[model samples]
Target: SQGEGPDPYDEILQAFKIMDTEENGFLTLADLKQICESVNLNFSNKIIQEMIEEADNTGDGKISLTEFTSIMCQTGRFKYCAPK
Candidate 1:
């Protein structure tokens, strides 16, 4: 559709990797804070913590790719259709 550009799922994974600065395979509070600031968003710590909690499905205070994908699907930002 977009002239053979990268898959949408790959794009999402790439974005997650970029945000995971710690290279620990998950997103922590500090990573979120740094990205927010880089994008000129001055979110308070409470707001950031809330964001983490919202997506941290495992309740481990960090967001893994599975958690991120679940949130995206819940928010209608991503939809997965199995091959027919």
Candidate 2:
């Protein structure tokens, strides 16, 4: 997969899979927090909650693959979101 060139989306999805260790098609707030920590993103709990609110369009308080992908693809990065 080394020569595939610029597969940031794929990389992000793979990370999503790894983070979603429960494999339940969604991530709890706790799970998201752990992921942020594992990647050394260093976000506060409030920031994580804000991200969840922005991505969890269904108001279920969990992030599904669709929602995660939407956010990741939209931002095209994983360093957290802020108004550009």
Candidate 3:
């Protein structure tokens, strides 16, 4: 039963994958904007840019999987945290 259940981490990975439409191993502003539109979030560019800035530890103007996971693990109900 343990192995049969879907892992929570898998869901996060899927979400990141969906956001990275170009499969470039990173989430760009355009990619995030498209995802927001698809989900009907209606977030303006300013807000979305701010969101990107908040999570972009590397200051590369894009979110790598590692950066995304760090934010996800830091907030919400996830108990794990990315290693420093």
Best by TM-score: 1
Candidate 2 has what TM-score?
0.68
Find the 10 residues in a row with the least total lDDT in model 1: 75-84
* Global fold similarity of model 3 (TM-score): 0.80
Ranking by TM-score: 1, 3, 2
lDDT tens per residue, model 1, 23-64: 899999999999999999999989999999999878999999
Identify the runs in model 1 with alpha carbons over 4 angstroms from their true place. 1-5, 79-84
True lDDT of residue 64, candidate 1: 98
- Which residue pairs show collisions in model 2? none
Pairs with steric clashes in candidate 3: none
Candidate 2 lDDT = 0.80
Instruction: List model 3 lDDT by residue over 12-72, tens digit each.
Output: 7888898899999999889999999998999999999999999999999999999998888
Give the CA lDDT, 0 to 100, for residue 5 in model 1. 61
Candidate numbers, best lDDT first, in rank order:
3, 1, 2
Per-candidate RMSD, Å: 3.2, 5.7, 3.3
Error of 1 at 43 (Å): 0.4
Q: Stretches of candidate 3 above 4 Å error?
A: 1-4, 79-84
